[model samples]
Target: MPCCPFCSSDMVYPLLNTLRCKRCKNIWKEGEENPGRPAACGSEGTSLRIRKKTDPLETRMKRKLDEYLTRSKGKFCFSAMPWQAGDISQELFMRYLKRCVKDRSLAEEKDRYGRTWYLRP
Candidate 1:
């Protein structure tokens, strides 16, 4: 079995040259040395390019806040409760949150800190 270059995990069987990480969903090509070389996904008609979708400003803010909060929850992290998630008054964050509510993208709930928490459905 080949190992992945990015994560060093076993290759996604059958496709020896392809390695996928579930945690990050990052795919890499295994090289001949230990990890196999990244196999080309190129094809005659395929553009062979992956593009990131530009998230709405609000969504972007929400994501940023999520990341910040995730990292902030340390031994002495901010004690803001779940109810405080709504305290994110950034215009972009509010817009995204409204959209999430309208589209049912995120769920509303209280956090350990009694703050409001949101997640994509």
Candidate 2:
């Protein structure tokens, strides 16, 4: 996930092998000038920028949850919950996560505590 250059928002999408910042609509390609990499600037307006990179399934889920919480303006009520989030609910989230893992062909992953989670394989 990439952070926005102007607002530090975690809305990013990959376009043509380049990372694009959704908030500011900034496009950066690897090996290019600036390269859209996260940088902590001390001058003004921008602080720390989060890199947009491929992440583990679990990590993605965490990021999604965090984003949801932030977007909902504290209206989200889940805490310490693990989910993938298609529409809503734990079951939907789990199902969505399983489908994602299968689609991404990451069928051989174990949870942090060695629990078999993905439905791929």
Candidate 3:
């Protein structure tokens, strides 16, 4: 996830290759000036950015959960969660959701309508 340039919120969800910042409501596509390649810290061509370019499935799912919760404000229908993104499947999403619930980072609720909603802790 990327940090917002203004409010520094990590609410920026990775929508494909784009990052949408929730705090500043800024949509940032990786600028042409700085390509997505990882840069090493140095005196001349230095970058403070610690690029964890590779994230495990769990981290990505957690970010997705946060993004959904932030966007929904409270309760959200289960169908709202993106079922698939490129190679990532809905099964993987559910797996991580269950893991999140196990870790207490997220909770699940059932509405009067009997629909399930994933929530933040």
Best by lDDT: 3
- Candidate 2 residue lDDT tens string, 4-111: 454455776678977676544455554344434434333233323334546544565556645755665533323433444442346534554566666784343555
- lDDT for model 2, please: 0.49
Off by over 4 Å in 2: 31-121
Residue 35 accuracy (lDDT) in model 2: 31
Q: Which lDDT values do the candidates have, in the order given?
A: 0.44, 0.49, 0.58
Please give the RMSD to the true structure for each candidate, in Å. Answer: 14.4, 13.7, 11.1
Instruction: State the lDDT of candidate 1 residue by residue for 1-121, as single tens digits.
Output: 4333333445334345455544223454444232222333432231212223365434556566577556655211232432343323444355556676688855566667676555545
> Candidate 3 has what TM-score?
0.48
Clashes of 3: 0
C-alpha lDDT of residue 27 in model 3:
52
lDDT per residue for candidate 3 within 26-121, as digits (tens), equals 455543345444432122342223223355545666677676677789555666654435323566567778887798877888878787888775
lDDT of 3 at 84: 38
Q: Candidate 3, which segments miss by more than 4 Å at Cα?
A: 1-53, 80-84
Could you give me the TM-score of model 1 versus the true structure?
0.29
TM-score, structure 2 vs. true: 0.25
Clashing pairs in 2: none
